[model samples]
Target: MMGTKLQVAVIGGGAAGLCAARHLLSRGDRFAPPVVYEVSDSVGGTWIYTDSVGTDRHGLPVHSSMYRNLRTNLPKEVMAFPGFPFGPHLPSFIHHSDVRRYLEEYAQHYGIGEHIKLFTEYPLPISSSSTRSRSRTLKEEDQKSYHPEEVAIKSFTYIIIRNRHYSDPYIPNVPGMEYFQGQVMHSHEYRTPESFTGKRVVLLGAGPSGIDIALELSQVAQEVILSHSRPPIASPLPGNVIQAPGVDRLSEASVLFQDGTERRADAFILCTGYNYSFPFLAEEVGLKVEGGVVSPLYKYVVHTRFTSLCFIGLCKAVCPFPHFNCQVLFSLAVLDGSCPLPPERELNAATAEELRARLESGFPARHFHKLDSLQWDYNNELAQLGRFEPLSPILKELYENCKAIRGRDLINYKSYNYKISSGSSREWSLLCPQ
Candidate 1:
């Protein structure tokens, strides 16, 4: 606050944004009070938007939206912030509502809530010609002509946001979807189950949401049809939960499959996920999306050429909140001159194509930008930034012992299992009556 501090903007007020902001403050480096722009009136991005108390479009109530008695997938020990451990009475897996509350608590504990600018949307700004040029050279007269405002603007940078909540649902073109549907709606519009009580329902896709709805309506609806292009993996756990083999495909829904084997239904709930897109940035920004996958950028951290601007929570197959927060802190350290940026190369056409091929190879042709396991990813990121040394043998043994205990299931709540040994305090309950 004393000198001219660098200006930074953080987009989105979800867990990722809060984590980034907290790290920025922790660094206590010379920087302007970082501005956090949240487009919603409240903080919780996806938690608030999701159907927490009502029915879904398929007439499945709020209770059906979530897995029956589901708990947090991650244990409390790893899920919580660095200093704030989950206290006693920790459940193996907490409820979604409890998770939302914990997010709010994290924001409050770190004093980040006060810094956030709610109800603000960020539309990407046009890049000025002077700012884009690669040449750093300036003429004698040009140097004298520079104004204070121009210099400050040049130094300022931004952090872009991408998440499931931002994406608009993708509903593919089916031949007679318009003709025979009694009631049709995308998952975005779905709210409750009162409407489908006695009606036959056909829920499309076999992802977590689709499976949840199918199981909820099976008993109430005359018949519940789960239509999928490929059979789900269906991993059977202690409870009657089935983990889908992989992500679902939207294009697989063809007229033939619908007519040949699919059951007729009173309504169709398309649980198909969203597409990879950013409405704000222009195509020339060099953020490439090939075959539904964004081009690989520097160990999935900072953009190769654009060091000032960073992205968080873009990786798939990992929990974005805590993992991304840890990654963002490392990135911030580099940006603040506390650490050095990792060595990386500019993405070329071939690299982009390779990423595209890798994304398509997954079970369902969807682009969530998959990565490896959480712990390994976190460790690699820390190493890339040169932030942490290898754990000592004693510490490593202790950590492994903790992970083993956390992995055990103590309570079988259907899709929600509580890993008692995980010692997660953030995992709480969101109990909805049947």
Candidate 2:
């Protein structure tokens, strides 16, 4: 048993951060009240959308990538935190505003707001040339305002780098971008489609955001070319929307595709994806994200060498809220000594081996943290190891059912509602209009 309550510093106030704070608060005997760092006044993290992009008033890079008119592709049934369900009357598929409201209510219910430090920015410690003095100074500043009791960060203190992963948008280097002479933007800057009316737009990825933006733009854009290297989408597309091969290069005013075809593009949007960024981390800490893979992490949550530094929600294609719950619980268990962690060397080897197997199976280096069908198994494993109740099987059933449904009917998938049968053996009911 720990002699003193451990102080946890939670970075970011999104769902993952809030989940960490809530769970930490619930364990009052074992934990000091958490200190949550958030850039905005709100606690919804990336779910909080703003008209402004690029930078905030404080000049911090905007953390949210949410564009206007985004609805939850995953139903609320699968999206809610394990124990906290959304309102019964709400549509299974909800708007971003509704999702934000849910997060706000959750924060209030758990009294997490009282512990949150708002409008705070954590500079990447490495940004300063001198690492030791910089880390000490930053720690001293943070120790001043910890409410209920101001406490010094001792050896047992844990830092949760919960800065959700959608901020650092990735746009691959395409040759001739300088001479293209067209307005090029990442989907992060996209707010609404009205500005591109009558313009021929080339969207340089076919990820969910890329496809959704194409649908949204089809209503306004004169022509939409969805450029991708993935297999062709089977869903019926709008008349103006056309699928094209990946871009080989760009000319003065057009994009050259790998198939040797060329398309005139008035504008270009890169929906490529994001990088795993932790600017606040110093080099001595030994975390690396190369080829879109974050390493030296055991179970992708705990730092192998420095177990005191934990990360939440570094994953992709997950039931984000539930995943956060499992991750937080397991991390706490490890930190509190209820569940012991392996040695640093063993942890590193195990971590590397799993990733190597994934790569050898033909998955790309960028998909190191992807947990699609694997998410259910991953979540259950954490619960088992952490001695917590496993997530209900019905959640997986609903999630996969919705995925198949969405794949076949992208346009009308969100229209369908789902209801979870009450109790442990959670049979689900799919609701469709008469």
Candidate 3:
């Protein structure tokens, strides 16, 4: 027996939300068309560049993390979603503007703009007992709760999007930090280097943002120190940049390192990363996060306790478009009753087992949500279970190869172009500068 059409609600009209709407619409009669809610006045979420950083005219915190000079680290070939190729004339590596234009074109080509409600925000779920109650809490002239007509379209509905985290950037606690007289700010507050052109800057953390910011600031800052707990960076750094051990404490005007070294800097930037947050989800949902990771998500998409509540594009360090494609299709299949899922207890056990293995393998608690090397296998499993085409093998091979090159030549890797040519079903070649 066929179930009633599901009315899916997609949150945050970014890459993931856009893909979800496209797939749900393509499913035709099986599902009611998806309604996308976007807080911003446009379809692109983080891709929409805004000069405003702290807050907008409406006092909402800015969500875009893109810097003015930022360009994609990955090639256009792999970045593009399946069946939607980037312009052939464009270079393999492109600027952020190009990506924004591409997303706009995608929305227009698929007629997704009409289905999206720009500037409309949905309230977080209340609770399982009153998930359907029509209660009015927050009032807004433009924003609103789901309408009866929309909810009545289907007996089941689901929404999927990546979690928002930039509203509150994480900062590590260090003794005497309160006495620091110099400027202290999170990387989320940093948009450009114009203000710090002649100042010495200390950046915490050595993740991608820290490395990229160090390089960016080296061009302007008098001195840039990348302080991190990890081993020294492998790539050559700019002349103005230096590496230092993790910070031990901060004195009024300087920082003391664990190695008994101290340096006074004009400013400190906490590139320590962000915390997982869902402002709209109710407290009783039990979607708790510990050590920067969300828990009890079966296959990292469906909630083990409530399978109807799913999350897509939650994994880190992946080919986002292809990954979203697999996840959305798999989730929709499950909702449509085509894919048989195990009991809730079994699903919860599976998630626990995976988390245990990852921790036992020496991965830190912070890396619980990271799917860097394991993403390919995970995507394949979703595709197999949902009976959809898995990501091309070339995608995995090229992604791994590019990561190595980036680490070795961080300064010049983006200068080269790449092309993927497939000769047979499984045979492919990645063409790049030798």
Each model's C-alpha lDDT?
0.53, 0.84, 0.78
Which one wins on lDDT? 2
Our model 2 lands, by Cα RMSD against the true structure, at 4.5
The digit string of per-residue lDDT tens for model 2 on 297-318 reads 9999998888887889998898
Task: Give the per-residue lDDT of model 3 (tens digit) for 1-434.
Answer: 13577766777788888888888889877888776767666777777777788776455568887778777888887788888988988877788888888988988889899988665555346354324522222224533332212222212256565565545688778788789888898877777888889998999898877888888899999999899999777988888899999989888888888899999888998888888777777777788888877877889898777677778877778887888888998998888889989998999899888888999999887787789879999999999999999888888887887899888888777777776565555444445566
TM-score of each: 0.70, 0.92, 0.91
Number of clashing pairs, model 3?
1
Per-residue lDDT for 38 in model 2?
A: 73
Indicate whether candidate 1 or candidate 2 has the larger TM-score: 2
Q: Could you tell me the C-alpha RMSD of candidate 3 in Å?
A: 3.6
lDDT over C-alpha atoms for residue 308 of model 1: 65
- What's model 3's lDDT at 8? 68
Query: Relative to the unseen true structure, what is the C-alpha lDDT of residue 99 in candidate 2, on a scale of 0 to 100?
Result: 95
Q: Which ranges in model 2 have alpha carbons more than 4 Å from their true place?
A: 1-3, 123-156
